[model samples]
Target: MRTVTRARLLIVCLLSLRYGGHDEPAAQSHGLFCASADAHPTPFILRFRKTDRAVILPAYLDHIFDAAAAIERKNARRYLYTNNNDSWEETPFNHPSTFDTLALDPGMGERIKADLDAFSKGESFYHRNGRAWKRGYLLYGPPGTGKSSLIAAIANYMQFDIYDLELTKVSNNADLKSLLMQTTRKSVIVIEDIDCSVKLSNRDGADEASEKATDSNTSCKLTLSGLLNFTDGLWSCCGEERIFIFTTNFKERIDLALLRPGRMDMHILLSYCTFHAFKKLARNYLGIQEHPMYLELDEAMRKTSIQLTPAAIAEILISNQDSPDVAIREVLAAFPKDMPNERAGNVDGGKCQLSHNESKQQTFRQTMFVFFQKTKHLR
Candidate 1:
């Protein structure tokens, strides 16, 4: 009996070894799996392959791998991004057909046209070493001289986004750099009324001393060197394909450091409208090719001290767009009856004078400003 029991126990041990040996090789050591509650008693089990530690909780590892894979898939093609604090609002900018179609001074118009053409062809006059693609325009003159209008015309012509930098909103050079970086390519960066934005440093010391004497509590965050470095320094090279436009009511007020050669690629003197400019405005606003008053208006423009700005002409034309005759009549009505011989000889008057044009330009500038402000507000 004892011999029979020993033989039975040996048979049982042999069967256990055979089953365990076959099971070890069938379990997989390394393979991923997602857990499903439907699977069985254990939340996860080893995928069948020959290894230990193959089983893992799908919640612990599967979700992490899935998230990583998702991120890689989403960011596969994006390369550029721009961010700014200013609200992204669309402002209507329609290029005035009259301004483009009319012939002003052939010489000035041709030069401006050539420059704009070059810009359209992707050629920058200042950049030499394949770095820092920027163009600067210094538009300086008295108020009511079509400075802002020129900006609008340029923007409309180029179809470029305008990044109107409010210097007061910028804290310092770093802030300025960040703002510049946020501007996309094929855009214009404008700093209008720059003279008032910051207290500029002066090399002559006279201007600096004068400013110091006048205001003691003044604190200037932007210095001349700071501005120069921002525009021309190596840092400016970070951006490509952009235009920098600076407009000031008084160029003389700006330090020479700001206006040195290469700093301002172009200095557009938006003076009062000449006889040529007036005729062009007429052709544009009023479609009268050959009016009876054409020669008289021309002679009047040449001889009369009355000087109308393009802005004033635009307002008169806009108000009477329905009737070219009314626009022409209004323009002539605004002119003085007696043309000043000396003033007429000078295309642009030196200072404020009692001329028909002077009064018209003043009124035009104010009215346009209000118009633009309202338009901007609406937007």
Candidate 2:
């Protein structure tokens, strides 16, 4: 009887294993492993049945994918930085100037856009030509001109970060090269007031040491040759799709090597305001494109020998934006009588014509002094 009982128990156990004893499947734990600490954390899930396998596994995988995508997006945003003591320091580059909003000549603006577009597409072209993918621009004009504004427009248009290089802060050539290397690809490196930044002369070791000892803070020992090498030399080729811009109030003061054909691919002269540029400002400030006084203002600007900058005109237009007639009248009255000859036709199409005559320079100084004095109240 005991042997029979044992056999019956064994048969019962085997039948239960074959037929499934429990009503639900056992719970199984799944782990979602992340590659980095910065990655989004995924929740643990317990799966039990064929239905759960069909729904829960796929949903968990999708969540992991979404988290990874979020991480990538957070890391992709660029920033503006400046060189500080041989290192780059991040700063806000929130400039509110675009190609449309910028007061640049239409033709010139279009050409700039075309050049940028071509450069952006010239990766294969660069490789084919065996050239470094870079371009340089020299923006030369007097103070209050739109050189800085133009730089801002380029940055905004390209959606690229700016690296405003302060050459004065750099200690030596090595420091300058290091700063350049730290910059990432696809950025505009701007050196504003390049003429005033440093003497930019290649001196002997004794002279360099004496200057360094005399005034370390004011004078930069970096030579013009060193600067050129950094811009167009082998080191520059390390980065691709880069733009270098040098701005100066005195273009004639800059070294010839810097203004050479290959060095500065384009030399944009931001000259005094023209009727065409004035129209742009009018449109920007006042909504009306064709006012009754348009003809009068056009004639007045044509008659005037003294030229005003775009900024000066913009100030006048904005002050009486509500009253275009008043603004036009004020601009006409403020126009100096014994003004210098119109510098050049339109900055966009015109070549830079620098006059080195002392008498002309003296006259310009006096006239500009008076011009600023009158506009000072407007500011």
lDDT of 2 by residue, 122-150 (tens): 99998899989888999987666688889
Q: In TM-score terms, which candidate is top?
A: 2
Pairs of residues at least 3 apart in sequence or in different chains that clash in candidate 1: 27-49, 28-49, 306-357, 307-357
Q: Which stretches of candidate 2 lie over 4 Å from their true place?
A: 1-78, 203-219, 336-379
- For model 2, where is the 10-residue window of minimal lDDT? 7-16
Displacement of the residue 322 alpha carbon in candidate 2, Å: 2.0
Each prediction's number of clashing residue pairs: 4, 0
Instruction: Tell me the deviation in Å of residue 211 in model 2.
Output: 6.3
How do the residues 62-129 of candidate 1 rate in per-residue lDDT, one tens digit apiece? 65566665566444332222223322334444445323754345476577657776766665543554
| C-alpha TM-scores of all predictions | 0.60, 0.71
Q: What is the C-alpha lDDT of each candidate?
A: 0.58, 0.70
- What is the alpha-carbon lDDT of model 1 when measured against the actual structure? 0.58
Output the number of the lDDT-best candidate. 2
